[model samples]
Target: MSESTKRWGLLRHHDFRQLIVAESISHLGSQITILALPLVAVAVLHAPPFQVALLMTFQYLAFLVVGLPAGALVDRMRRRRVLVAADLGRAVLLGSIPLAWALDWLSMPQLYVVVLLSGVLTVFFDVAYQSYLPHLVREEDLVEGNAKLEAVQNVAMIGGPAVGGLLVRLVGAPIAVLLDALSFLGSALFVGRIRSVEQAAPRPERTRIGQEIMQGLRFVLANPVLRAIALSTAWLNFFSAILESMILLLLARTLGLSAGVIGLLLSLIGLGALAGALSARRVTDRFGQRRMIWVSIVVTAPFGLLLPFAREGWLLWAAMIGWAVTYFGGTVYNIAQVSLRQALTPPNLLGRMNATMRFMVWGTLPLGSLVGGVLGQYLGVRPAMLVGAIGYLFGFVPVVLSPLRRTAPAPVGEVADDLPGSEQPVRK
Candidate 1:
């Protein structure tokens, strides 16, 4: 290898360094919003359980609304531009929240609108950002690149919540959102500075939007590995959303925990994620890629049963442990599956493949939140959480039954050609 090439590990890779900076900034901002947004709903707006669920629903609803079309559109444009635009758009939307609060013009309906708009922009940014990574690094370095990004991202995750909680305690929830808005602007600046020249790959014939969307879906369904990932993750996310939707309120209302303590508990998940990010490559290397995907969830998800057992006294330890364990497993599983997906997909199809899988996995989150809110209202929070744990326990079935259980990792270029219907997309 050339000396220059050897030195350009993701740290030295200019374009990738910028991408990492952008993502790291964005992740921190997102973590802050995660805590602050819910606080706003619960404390300021006095939204009910179902209404809180509606807020969460608005935050992710874009995936269901425009996911497929966004994927098709991303494939036809320069990815970096899409990312920049999304970041700037989110900045404006989130910035509006603080402005509205200062003017005493903030309302629940306005918050919902802002959240929904932010989600739509996020959908666009994520589709473009995930698709653009491979172009920044060598094919073999994809895993390392992803891990590096996640590592710092976990750091931001760890700190952002703690800071956000303190800010909410001191200043207020609406004011805390301004930090997120500023961070988005920073992310946009970093992303816009990347010098990589992104151009749409030339095609012999352009297909209709519906066909392009279908092509992406077919590719995922036809590939056993991708199909397994989509199904297992979809189920896991569904149940996870159920449990997570109530955690903040559970801590605050039922347990009467302060925002600082609640944030500390949430940061434990970030701590676990950081550990998982650091060890993902090593763990996957030792266990083999596909095996770890299902194994991680099977082993970790059972801890979720402990969550509902948590109560005010020492029992709160049970919830914290469960949160940490489940998060660790999730982080490891994500690193393995995401790297595998990026490696296995053809570069031309990366955007669509990621979008399709996201639609499958994340589309269920809002539904899960809604169901969780209903269960929390009707059955009580702990019982609802218990039910979610049961779902997680069985969520591994789809992947366990598929061929991925026995598969091993392989290079990206070698993997895609053998998948069924891969050749047909180019022809159409």
Candidate 2:
């Protein structure tokens, strides 16, 4: 397919549209839960700051535990089936939360279980979803598809939090979570409606799971571009977790902001991300993808430094401005890097590549949340945020030192000396 033929009209693609719709609804629901779940922990269960952070930890813990195996498993199944199962599973688990609350039996441990189960399902859904995309559109269309999907997601995120806040104030956090459950159902329906035939990979002969998993690990670590992306992304996520673990608590506890105000603030952060998503294609086209990778972080990450200085009154607006800027930079970086990863990786290894990246990148989040929560308890909120801000400044170092800085499209398939061979051996 040529560039001109691939230009625009993605929504005209039936399966791609279904995917976009499904993912858009799911993103909205996830954002609502992101706000509502923490509120439930803090308000109803009366969880301490550490426990609240632990809730965040549970949400990413599955990435560390099941991430590698899940990749190998996803490689063996229909990707859409995995997505549907994940959505339905999350619906059932999240729906249980509202029921427990109604029965007046909701406990901190149960909430922990809900988040952990949801997290596990989410890992599968995410890995499968990314792998499935190439099957839906041309390689040239990946950037546009991702950009449009990300833009819609950001729009949903913008409204979802405000709606969640209103729902929390009116019906309560438990019921707000119920809305998310229904959204997952809606997503499942849309996904299942797709008419596109997904051709499953031929079943490989028996092989050791560890060896298969190592193939993925070797591919990632061997490729210089992927290695740098993994390192830089992991570093960024660690600091991002540290910064985010305290945002709501700081706004509510220290600044004495209400739920509605906090939700609005969160929505404002999405506005920045939306802007970045809207501009992603244009920016990358103008600056070149390679330069945009590091440039995005360097230009906007510094805004995070303004957060620790935020105070009540007019200064609250300043805090939000800082958050918006950081959000913008992060979104642009995500869109560009994700598209690059997809383009570089071969189809057979897509599931493992995505999972391995998530394992390395998202795996750091749990520890970072714990550390931030503990540090906030000891060092105070502003100081903890200051430390996170300083960490963000260094996230660009790995990319700056790598081939991604100089090349238009970084070279793929180059295995390092200390690792397995570059070619992934067929299991059979």
Candidate 3:
């Protein structure tokens, strides 16, 4: 199929439009709820700073612990159904927060459980959704489709936080969470209406659960490109996590920015990401997705470095704008990388492959935060930001050192050394 033909087919498809709309609503809800949940932990529950950090720790633990398993389940089940069920589950779990608050039962412990449940459901939705993508659009438009989804999400990320900040300020944090829960319900309704039949992957012969887990691990390990991307992203997430815990504190005490101000700036980062996503495919088509991936990774590499330079007034404004550009570029890199991966990976192993990759990608976040917390305590937030930035920038090292920089697309399962000798081999 010609590139022009692929592009036209994707643009003409009605199903993609419906999927994008439902996904946009869901992403917007996610953006708002993520912001609201932390506020509930801090302002309403009166959580100590450290304990507030723990909330994210518990929430992301599923990404580390159960990501692979969840991927396996997604592969074995109906992908679209899993996505709808996950959204509905999140709706119910998040709705409980406000109900508990109303009944005077919304303890900090209860918040923890809700956070855990939300994280678990998110893992399922994300892995399943990624696996489901090939079925929704034609082969050629995968990058465009993913790019559009990222664009919507980037817009939502900006809008959601900005709205959340206002909503939290107007109506307490618990109620802010209810808004998110409602959004999930909205997503569920639209997603349920979509009528695509996601054909299932043929399940391999039964083996011990451990073997299946190892199989996923080995596949990624054997694939250099996948491994490099997984580690690069995971480490970036880890280094960024360092600043994540300390940023609110730094802005609150050191930089003296108000919550609303900080939230708005954060929205700028998301807006920038949306811009990146909107342009990513065009950039990739013109420059090659592989090259764009490296450029975006390298350009946005200093997300942590911008923190120390932030100051009151114009200085902070400059810093936020810089950070926003980097954030946007990073989104483009992800769009390119994930789309490239999707295009290259075989349909049968897509679920386990996505799960394996994400387990590595998201697992590094909390560990990075823990290290950041200790460094922030000892070295101060500014110095820690500098340290993390230097580390974060190294995400480029893998691409810089590897063949990925010059690689061109091949048919699925034949992309250089980016995959296992054969899919589903057992790893140590």
Candidate 4:
């Protein structure tokens, strides 16, 4: 078989195909919510810049609250069950928004509560989803699997926003959210039909949840490469959150762009990300994974500075181009780093390791959103975005300075035993 065929072979597996379908549907819905949820607050409710930012804060706060514990819980449960349940729960939560709106009872508090609860479910779903993939594909195929998944997500983003924007304009934002709710039901159906059985890891005779959580934490922190990747990713997420919390506000309020136009502009990020996902394997093959990780960020992130200058006419076009390039770099960086993390981890610790890593990386999102809200409310939207755009340039520093620069990518089916501070043997 050709190398290309080998890479694409995972699509032939029945269970993996189901996962792809589920992810495709789920991601398309999520892309709609990504645009519509904030628009609900900003357009429908007349939320101030600070309050609109709080929507993001509420959505991500669950990662910090339950991220580590969810990892331990997932390690003890069936990951597939966790995934299906999370999807169903999200469906119910999101479906409530339109119901409340139809009753003339929709309020900011209800919106906050819905996003917060759904985010909790998301934390579990994401942890299980990442941990579950290894069971369905070969070790060598991890990068291809992750890249395909990322590509599906970006593809959804490319179309979802435009559709969502039109829906928001015509049917209203609350009604647009109902479509997301229905999509989750379809995702749950696909996930439930997956036939592959997960082989449970052996449990210790006497184990504490805290100890398991700590083990995952130690594994990440002790490894120089994991440590640096976590730090760099966290930094990137922090500033990116700030930028996202305000970008809609800038477009809708400052530029006075229509919902349809805002959606089209945002689609550029998805477009660039799709290009990056399609290119990641080739880029890694040519440059090597280590170089690809840092270089992707360093080269493309600087373009984010152009975002602050976005105005009517040519500047808007320049800003959108820069936005797309930045997402392109981020997509490439994520695929390379995530594949490395999955390759380096042992099977027994996969859930916990992913949880710990997410806790560290995604935990910054809420804090950044809160800060952005304050900055936008007090310092002004454009200036706040400038702060975030500037911070993007420095996100690569941790990875560039770490030992990851010197090490080769981990080989398939084997941990990088030669690396300093590799994971310790799991305690029984």
Q: List the residue pairs that clash in candidate 3.
A: none
The 10 consecutive residues of candidate 1 with the worst lDDT sum are 419-428
Evaluated at residue 18, the lDDT of candidate 4 is 96
- What's the number of clashes in each of the models? 0, 0, 0, 0
Q: Per-residue lDDT of 296-366 in model 4, one digit per residue for the tens? A: 99999999999988999999989988989999999999999998998788766778889999999999999
Query: Model 3 segments beyond 4 Å from truth?
Result: 1-12, 203-208, 253-256, 377-379, 414-428
Least well predicted 10-residue stretch by lDDT in candidate 4? 419-428
106-145 per-residue lDDT for model 1 (tens digits): 8889988999999999999989988888777776788888
- What is candidate 2's TM-score against the reference? 0.94
The TM-score that candidate 1 achieves is 0.94
Model 1 residue runs over 4 Å out of place are 1-8, 408-428
lDDT of 4: 0.89
Q: Superposing every Cα of model 1 onto the true structure, what RMSD results?
A: 3.1
In terms of lDDT, the best-performing candidate is 4
Q: State, as a TM-score between 0 and 1, how close model 4 is to the true structure.
A: 0.95
TM-scores of all candidate predictions against the true structure: 0.94, 0.94, 0.90, 0.95
RMSD of every candidate to native, in Å, equals 3.1, 3.2, 4.1, 3.1
**TM-score preference between candidates 1 and 4, better one:** 4
Taking the tens digit of each residue's C-alpha lDDT, what string does model 2 give over 177-260?
998999999999999988876665543455577876887888788788889999999999999888888887888778887778
